[model samples]
Each structure stands twice: as C-alpha cells, then as structure tokens.
Target: MIDFITGRGLLLLSLRRMYELWVNHSSQIIKQFSILIGLPLEMSNNSDSSLEVFSPAKFPKAMNELSALLEAIAATSIYFKAEIVVSYIKSHSLRIEWIEANPALAKIVTSGLLKTFSLETLFEANRNNKNFLRDVENHISKQLLAG
Candidate 1:
C-alpha cells in the first residue's frame, strides 16, 4: 500500500510538471507570434491570469486574430484549469479610460464581447466564433466613431 501511494504521488507530480511546461511553451509561442504579427501582447500572472492585446489600429482583422488567439488560450486552459481574463486596449488611452469611467457601457460592452465564447463548455474552444468578433468590432466602431 505504501508503494502504491508513493507511485501515485509521483504520477501526480509528473502530470503537474507536464502541465506547467505546456503552459509555458504555449505562452512563449503566443508571445513570439504576436511580435511577428506586430501585435503587442502582454500577459500577467497576477491572482487572475490576464492577457492584454494592444491594438494600435483597432482594425477588424486584428480584432479577429486577437479573438482567435484568445479562444485558443481558453481551450488550452480547460486541461490546465486556469481562468484567463482577456482585455483589448486600443491605441487611444483616453478612450479606454472613458469606457472604464462609464460603468454601464463597460458592462454592456464586456458582456457582449464575452458572449462570443461559451466558456462554460469545457475542453472546447470556439476559435471560429466570428460573430463575437463582429459584435465587439461593431461596438468599438460605434463608440469611437460617435466620439
């Protein structure tokens, strides 16, 4: 029985190490790709893991790519059991501040954007959720254009 318990503990340790390695490898890949594509990606390992993708142009295609990358990360998080919060920062810092100041608008926009991903669905990342991207793009366009 003691030997069995020791073997089980070792197995668990190995699995955890593998998960950590995969997470690190995946993050590096994402960072490299973001740099190659000229997108500024910042990942933070605070209490709540968060990824911030800075879009200098706020282009639709760029947003789409960001959404795809986010979905991929979300899919991977299932096995690793991590919750990742994603944020998009536009080029205009003032605009982001304005959005944050307006709690109602912030909630609406955030909810609309997150609606694209069924995060409750474990192990499946909806990388092809273009509708969510469209919704987010439309909302941002309207806000920026109106201003």
Candidate 2:
C-alpha cells in the first residue's frame, strides 16, 4: 500500500514538473513574440487598426489553432503520466485499495488531469463567463486566508 501510494505521488510530481516546463516554455515564447510583434506596432500607431491586428477578434482561427497545439502538448504529457501510473500498478500488482483510500488521486485519475487543467476551459470561462478570473482570485484568497 505504501509502495502504491508512493508510486502515485511520484506520478503526480512528474506530471507537475512536465506541466511547469510546458507553461514556462510557452510563456517565454509568447512573451518573445508579443515583444517583437505587438510592442512595435502599438508604439508606432495608437490606431484601431494596430490594435485590431493583434486583437483576439482579428485572429480567432489562429488563436484557436495555437490553443489546440498547446492543449495537444499538455494532453500528451498527461497521457504519458497516466501510462506510467498504469504500468506501475500493473508491474506491482497493486489493487484498487489505494485508489479507494485516496479519493483525491482517484478523482484526478478518473476525470483526467488534462481536463482539470485545460487551457481551453480557462479561455472559455474568461470569454463566456465574465469575472471568471476574479472568482478564481477570490477563491484562492479565501483558501489562503483559511490556511
């Protein structure tokens, strides 16, 4: 049982590490591109056209494509992690008892980490549900305060 829990914890840690790498790399790339493309254009002209070019409205398709690419990358990592966990369970002949004992891990594994951490979900929430970030911030603030 300890081995089973340890293996799952390690899998979660690996997933987190992979996710951090993806976020860091994607953020750096986005920052570089925004600096190169968005900054110069904004500086040159404070016009609607300049803003429009960089706006989400102007390049919805491109934004979607980029989002899909990022999702694919994240999903791949999650799938890899899931595979590792499954392989460990199989090799050790671990039973379902560990999952039953750890409800949090069970939920994550069953529903999938990718779905829970989805960027598309974030974007959708931001777009369709205004104040999503504010809600998230408030929730975090409450949690921190409680802690």
RMSD of each: 15.1, 19.7
Tell me the lDDT of candidate 1.
0.40
Q: Which candidate number maximizes lDDT?
A: 1
TM-score of 2: 0.21
Model 1 regions lying over 4 Å from their true place: 1-7, 23-26, 36-38, 43-147
TM-score of each predicted structure versus truth? 0.25, 0.21
Model 1 clashing residue pairs (backbone): none
lDDT per residue for candidate 2 within 1-147, as digits (tens), equals: 112345777878777877887787986775665453322213225433322222343334433543443343343323233323332222322246654554443444444432323223333324433344344334323422332
After aligning candidate 2 to the native by TM-score, how far in Å is the CA of 12 from where it should be?
Answer: 0.3
Best by TM-score: 1
